[model samples]
Target: MPLTFRKSFQILPGVRLNINKRSWSITTGGKNGPRHTHSSTGRRTTSMDLPGPFGWRKTRKGGGH
Candidate 1:
């Protein structure tokens, strides 16, 4: 298997900091609510769960080359 590294720290309620081999990100939200993530690599992600086995997600890149 390929080497991998990832860790997460809870900064506050509904907030966390995630670190990986390539980048770091901040996540905010609860499991039942909409969540958002902003990465050091200039990528942003938003996700939310539905009533059933469904979910919603969106991704938007930052102003970077």
Candidate 2:
């Protein structure tokens, strides 16, 4: 199995800093609101939670997904 590493730090009430082996990202937003993320590898993502198991996510990256 492939191994992965990740960690998150809460900077503020609605802000977070996430780090992985290859890159890092900052996310801002609340649970009931739309969340936005931008990574160090030129990836931008916006996601939102829905009523149940349904949710929405859109991601754009400079290199590949």
Candidate 3:
């Protein structure tokens, strides 16, 4: 498998957001076994995905996420 790089931001003490800048794909028996492409549309993740102090809450412009 290929490795992925990401940048993360901490909105709160235990809350975080992640951003990825690339897309990845894998193929078997192809000229290129794996391929990675740079993308402008990135992915995002938040601490709300896990069971923790964070929940489905609205965030203000300069507040939580």
Candidate 4:
């Protein structure tokens, strides 16, 4: 199996938000990743300390999946 590193952020316990950049930025692995708001501030990494609205679970549209 190929190993893939996914840049993700955690808003709160059991909740994480994946980075999805539309443009090329240094924070976004340059072109392939999504640009981060924390990266523009000359920060090597961004902090993912926040509260999540929903628990750790995949959100489904319309009805439950």
lDDT of 3 by residue, 10-31 (tens): 5544334445665432211212
User: Each candidate: RMSD to true structure?
Assistant: 2.3, 2.6, 16.6, 14.1
Task: Name the candidate, 2 or 3, with the larger lDDT value.
Answer: 2
Give the TM-scores of the predictions, in the order they appear: 0.86, 0.90, 0.26, 0.23
- lDDT by residue (tens digit), candidate 1, 14-38: 9999999999999999998899999
lDDT of 4 by residue, 1-65 (tens): 95655466656544445543432113222222332333322334422322554222222333322
- Candidate 1 Cα outliers beyond 4 Å, as residue runs: 63-65
Per-residue CA lDDT of model 2 for 1-65, tens digit only, reads 99999999999999999999999999999899899999999999999999989999999988466
Scored against the true structure, residue 50 in model 3 reaches a CA lDDT of: 29
Q: Compute the lDDT of residue 7 as modeled in candidate 4.
A: 66
Q: Model 4 misses residue 60 by how many Å?
A: 7.6
Looking at model 2, residue 63 earns an lDDT score of 42
Comparing 1 and 3 by lDDT, which wins? Answer: 1
The candidates, ranked best first by TM-score, are: 2, 1, 3, 4
Per-residue lDDT of 1 in model 4: 100
